[model samples]
Target: MSSQARVSRQIIIQPTGEKPRKDRPMVHYKDRAELKDSVARAARTVWPGNARISVEITGHWSACTGRIFVNNRDAASFAPIVPRTAPETEAFDFGGQAS
Candidate 1:
């Protein structure tokens, strides 16, 4: 006999005033361990201290998607470190290089 289990996790970062970006796609993981690791990584990048962070999961045994929301009071602590926009990168030429 073999065991098969998997879960789809959707991570949403609700900032103070802005609405959650539903356009983003959810991430799938094989187990809870993998999901936890990925969530931690995301938390590090975005200051979840002041926003509403949620994780929705759907899978076998648990067909219904459950949502867990958390509010981080210390979110403002790391506001200065987070970049508002992507850094500018040098332009690239692929069509036979620039003359």
Candidate 2:
């Protein structure tokens, strides 16, 4: 993308991909945490095994909502969620000359 384009010649561009969707799908509660809990309970009922069943919800809030499906029967390939990094401390270098 060139930054030198004049305002008059600029063309509006829309983002491509699965547009924004709500992390919470249902309209029952306005909270994403609430939805997660509700889904966990429902999932437990559906999957009785204690082998480790996890539910992940993702999407934007306005556009098309998300749906859930089970993939435990086969190895589910997924990228782990990246953890937020800690804030860095600003450094002030002291003159190397010995006191």
Candidate 3:
């Protein structure tokens, strides 16, 4: 890795539910870069690059939490993180009719 590489990368924050809440928008990103951008934009508003970010899971199951660990810390110390794609939907989504 190059020294110029960003030591402070962007962190992601997302909410989890069986179905997305209609009232509240669920954060979705096209790719990792987009996610990073969103995080950077938010962090810039509040705190500068001095602070580091971590993701947490506050749901029933760890798997559903969609939490990610950037630094040595677990996805709990900071905020919650979610992937661009949901883990369950990663494989395939069932059709209208059941098999």
Clash tally, candidates in order: 3, 5, 4
Which regions of candidate 2 are displaced past 4 Å? 1-28, 61-99
Best of the candidates, TM-score: 1
- Give the range where candidate 3 is weakest over 10 consecutive residues by summed lDDT: 90-99
* lDDT of every predicted structure (CA atoms): 0.38, 0.30, 0.33
- Compared with the true structure, model 2 gives a TM-score of 0.32
Q: Write the residue-wise lDDT of candidate 2 on 1-99 in tens digits.
A: 323211111111111233322222222223444444544444444445645544444453111123334444321212111113512221111111112
lDDT for each residue of candidate 1 in 3-95, tens digit (9 for 90 to 100):
434545344544445675343334444554455445544554554453565444434312222333356342211111112352322111111
Give one digit per residue, the lDDT tens place, for model 3 in 1-99: 222222222233332333332232223333344344444344333334435644333342212223434343332222333335646553232111112
Q: Global lDDT for candidate 1?
A: 0.38
Native-referenced Cα lDDT, model 2: 0.30
TM-score of every candidate: 0.33, 0.32, 0.26
Off by over 4 Å in 1: 1-10, 16-18, 21-26, 48-99
Global Cα lDDT for candidate 3: 0.33
For model 1 the local lDDT of residue 12 reads: 58
